[model samples]
Target: MRKTATTLADGRELIYFDDTEPYTSGAATRELRDRRDLDPVAATSTMRYDVLTGEWVTLASHRNSRTFLPAVAECPLCPTRADRPATEIPAEDYDVVVFENRFPSLARGAEPPATDHVDGDDLWPQRPASGRCEVVCFTSDHDLGFAELPLPRVRTVLAALVDRTRALSALPGIAQVYCFENRGEEIGVTLGHPHGQIYAYPALPPRTEALLRQSRAHHARTGRVLLRDVLDAERRSGRRIVATTEHWTAYVPAAARWPVEVHVAPNRDVADLTELRDPELEDLAALYLDVLGRLDRFFDGVGKLPYIAGWHQAPVEEGRELGRLYLQVFSLMRAPHRMKFLAGSESGMGAWISDTTPEAIAARFRAIAPGPVPS
Candidate 1:
């Protein structure tokens, strides 16, 4: 792959990952100059400490005015063409591209707040939300979804993500790096373009904290990796197993809370995507596409199933040894026409209630599995 990095008109970073002939061979160059007149980025987001839950909540009020469901002609994610207005990507076409978010919840180079307390209360401390948020455009074809991508294109996307993860993890004060995609309108995806997001957080998220606690405790008692053990147990039980490959396994968690949930783990223990070998990455691309195809077929008449898929990686500076990398995919679609809303028990409290059992979900997934894809 050929990687070319350039700056946007607004001073944000944009990168292109080219896998095709001329670009990869250095016979041609990507359009690096962003000529459109644009204003400089203004970052004013802040993080307030929630005393009750011991979590940091980012307040990016400016995001309220962000672009929402614009027409296809105005989609900023599309490639820049002469007939159309210049978009976020300066190139006329691209295999894969990633750029800083125009309206980010977190931003780079933010100055520290003058006072740490909120309303003179010692419990409510606040600070600048100094972090990085990026958007990964999977394809220039605005109509194509990720699952419909060719295998080579999928591989390029994975490579770009691994490259970003390594680069983001090396950045100062970045606690964790997360790569995720929210698909479909029901999943609250504002953009119809095929894309995902990368977040470099200044602080560890609550979910990572909870996972670390469990892993640490499990290691202390048994001296074995928690997730590795879970994978082994799941393989032995074979009850929630959805799909398995030479390097990966897809299964439903025994206590799944989503209407449809599947966790994909490496057969070998790895802390993050950066640790995955070439063979493993290739296997992942194939398995991911296959699983996603099955998900679309899971609910008849539902068309494309709206789901959230995220990579759970180890923190940059903490719990690396105890961490096991995995991809968690879940959808809010409880039925063909019904949606699962996080009610009082789930949203108000940290408790989850499931409408279907994990075994049933897994069985359905197994039944609908598309077998394999051509290389």
Candidate 2:
């Protein structure tokens, strides 16, 4: 793959990842320049450390004014078209594109400066939410989604993700780099576009923090990688396995909290997406695409199932050794016509209530799997 990096009108960076041969030969037809005159990028988001939960909360008031569910003709993620106004992507067509988010919750060099004179206030500790947020466009078309893309195109998307993961991890003050996709309207996806988000967080997120703690404890006790052990247990049990390849495994976790949840982990102990070898990448794409296809087929009457797919990676600064790369895909849809909403037990207490068992979900996934597994 060839990378062509350029700057958007708003001074944000945009990169185009193109495949060799036919795509690169016809690259001249693609838009290489931004036609729109936009203002400079600015971010004032601040993070306040919560001593109670031991997590940072970002206050990005500007995000309230962002575009929400725009019409297809006005979707900012779509490629710039002659029939409509210029969108966020200035390209006429692109196999895959990633650009700095305009309404970002975190940004580079946007950190609040340090104060030397103030007394150490433990109760009101705040810092600049200085980190980068990039939007990964899976394709030029506005109607298609990641799960609907061809395998080759899916590989192209993974290439872009690997590129961004490596690049974002190198940025200063970046602690954790998370790549995630929010699909369907029920998932609170503001934009109905075929795109995912890369958030370079200023600090370790709550979920990653929990994983690091558990993994470190497990490693200290058993002298083995926790995720690898879990994968082994799943394979041995042969009950929750969703799909498997030589280099990857997809399973509905035994303690799955969501109605539909599956975790896809690389067989190797890769710290991040960048460490995935070529063969692993190839098979990862195929197996992930298969898992996604099964997800869409899991429900009958529901159109496109609303789901959140998140990549859990190790922090950039610390505990990377304990970090195991995995993708957690889950949905709140409890049934074909019913949606599970987080109420008092989940929202107020943080305790998840699952309407279905993990084994049942795994059985549904197994039934929809494209091919039968080996004995």
Residue lDDT tens for model 2, 103-187: 9999887757364112467676788889999999898878887777888888989988988999999988889999999998887
The TM-score of predicted model 1 comes to 0.96
Model 1 over residues 95-181: C-alpha lDDT tens digits? Answer: 899999999989998667778888868999999999999999999999988888999999999999999999999999999999999
TM-scores, one per candidate: 0.96, 0.94
User: Can you give the lDDT of residue 172 in candidate 2?
Assistant: 83
Could you tell me the C-alpha RMSD of candidate 2 in Å? 3.4
Model 1: residues >4 Å from true position, as ranges? 24-32, 371-375
Residue 33, model 2: lDDT of 68
lDDT of each: 0.90, 0.85
Query: Which residue pairs clash in candidate 2?
Result: none
Give the range where candidate 1 is weakest over 10 consecutive residues by summed lDDT: 23-32
